[model samples]
Target: MNILQAKVLKSCLNSEEKVLYLPGNLSQFQMALILAESSKFNSFIFANKYETLARDYVNKNSSSKVKFFLTETSVADFLPIIDKVVVFFGAVTPFIINSFGKIILTCLRTRTPLYEVPHGLFQTGQNLVDNSRLINTDSFYDGVGENLPSLTNVKLSWYGENGFGYPRTVLKDAYPARVIPKFTLVTSNTNWFLYSLSDKRMFYKVLFDYAKRNSDEIFIWCPHPAELLPNTLSHSVIEFRPSNLLLYGLHNDIYFYNIESTDDLIPYCEYGISTVSTCLLDYEMHSKRVNIFNCAGVKNLIAAFNHASAFNSSKEISHNAKIINTGMLKNFDALKFDQLLSQEVSKENFIDYNYLAAYV
Candidate 1:
């Protein structure tokens, strides 16, 4: 936030008033931290799954005092009294979507203001589905990255730069995955997210087998929260469920970490391994070597889902066939909650995703 905006927001809010924070996904949760840092206030996190990266951010460090809930509607009692509502990212989950709809209605009924901010570009396929549910917002804030397809009626505020500065050093209380001297960053999303590419079982088997075959090189398995969160996609997910024996089978060289963001693992290792993750953009920013897996599957998904206007949609997919490995990476960047700024966006930009969710 700029000096003028912060001052204006602080002045509009009375001493006892509270702010509502609703982050769409774990990675986008960073928007809450940035807002809290700029404006000290109380916050509420909606549907942040247990043990996920976003949940870790709540438990460890935050810019403002925070309390999390199981769903967005859970905050209904608090909404009436809230001075302002800030949706850091867009909502994708069913419960989050429903609750956010309620928040919008309450805001409209009570004359409360809402702000929606963009955490990143609309890389996630749900951009159209999730944003379509949002009928109105009070203000809109644009970030440093690519702008959302232009908004016609609402005023757009430019944040100019992402608050973390460039080349994020570290988040407060955030830690990197533990590793022996030489290890590759093994990150992935569950098959539940990418229904079209049902390869979770095969992905883990290849990872575990590779770990056993190459015990000398360390592997840090940073599984995405989508794989761990409790969900009801059992029937569909069974297609690629990994064997329990493989999950428990330990190769001493392989390890895992419960960190806030996978970016925390970057400083520890140079080269990395993954399937379909936007987090690979972090590696690209560092100019590091990225070992890609399931090149054809990743390409197929891209060709299958790429909307006419998406840019850098799958930055992780290496065009060179030589770097291809034998597994699937997760597309954790599929869901996002824009920053907590309110405004209307050009609805035409949304991709109509009917097939695979593009989930990680």
Candidate 2:
């Protein structure tokens, strides 16, 4: 509102090559901070939508790297200051296309450098930046993930991710990236509870089987956040390890820990296994060998691509790992899948980034 601040804010949006971010959720906001930290040009973000979240992320984890601006009216008026438009999308649901399409379509109309950051691990399909009128800018990817492929005109581009599960804007020196010599990280996912995939996708079962083969390694069972809920049928399985360690590690077979966050243990894990969890991407990035239980993510990516050229800039997902993606929907029911997907897109959980004076 001050004269000096207004000038700077206007300059940020008007300046060439400056990216204005519209993050729909905390994940998107955090990702924007990471990108801003790396960008040679300054990054501008809407202050009205997430000033509180912005300030909180900066106070806790990020340094002062991003500029926040508030528009008296819709910031859409100051389009000239924006060099590029970027949004983070995981799945291309109808809800998402509606919520974010406004700014994206606007930028495309002007032939601006419109880029989309598909934050999901695989980010399969066409990528993002789906423009009908013109060839949109390439979609930026952080890591490999299983997500809905973007529409045509959206190309995959590499921006590379430093790390997730941490604060944005600034990198902390405390959590150094180093792998444990003989530790295997096992992740819990929703599929584990399903009887169909239980035999193959079960975390404890796979760990036990894998442990039997490699006695030298310690398998750590880091359950997903929702797994421990007492209401679930698997509550009895929770042995209540107060000490949070030692699951008959006689030959270092298995070690179970009930921790709130796996941010610390994740990096130390040399090997990892998961089915559809986002952490699998992190494991693939940091771990030596990552064993994914299901090949759905891999299969989808292959189906989306014409050939192997898309994998050229991929930092994770290499041939060294045990990545086998068969594009067949073996046990998948097409009708059931379509119904579920339709329901999900129709439900509309898309968080809108609108102006709010709730900054702390």
Task: Give per-residue CA lDDT, model 2, range 1-360, as digits (tens).
Answer: 212323334332333356676676545565566666555555777654677765665566545667765552355765666765555653344545555555555544454544455554443442322212332123211222333343212222232221122222132233554433455565655423222334333434444444555555555666654455666533445454222223322233342343224444556666555544455444433433555443332334434422221121113323245533322112212233222212212112111211111110
Q: What does the lDDT read for residue 242 in candidate 2?
A: 24
- In model 1, where is the ten-residue run with the lowest total lDDT? 328-337
The global C-alpha lDDT for each of the candidates, from Candidate 1 onward, is: 0.43, 0.44
What lDDT tens digits, residue by residue, belong to model 1 across residues 261-349?
57656556646666556555455444455554553234454343212111122333222313222122212221111232323323332
Error of 1 at 253 (Å): 10
* Model 2: worst 10 consecutive residues (lDDT sum): 351-360
lDDT of 1 at 219: 56
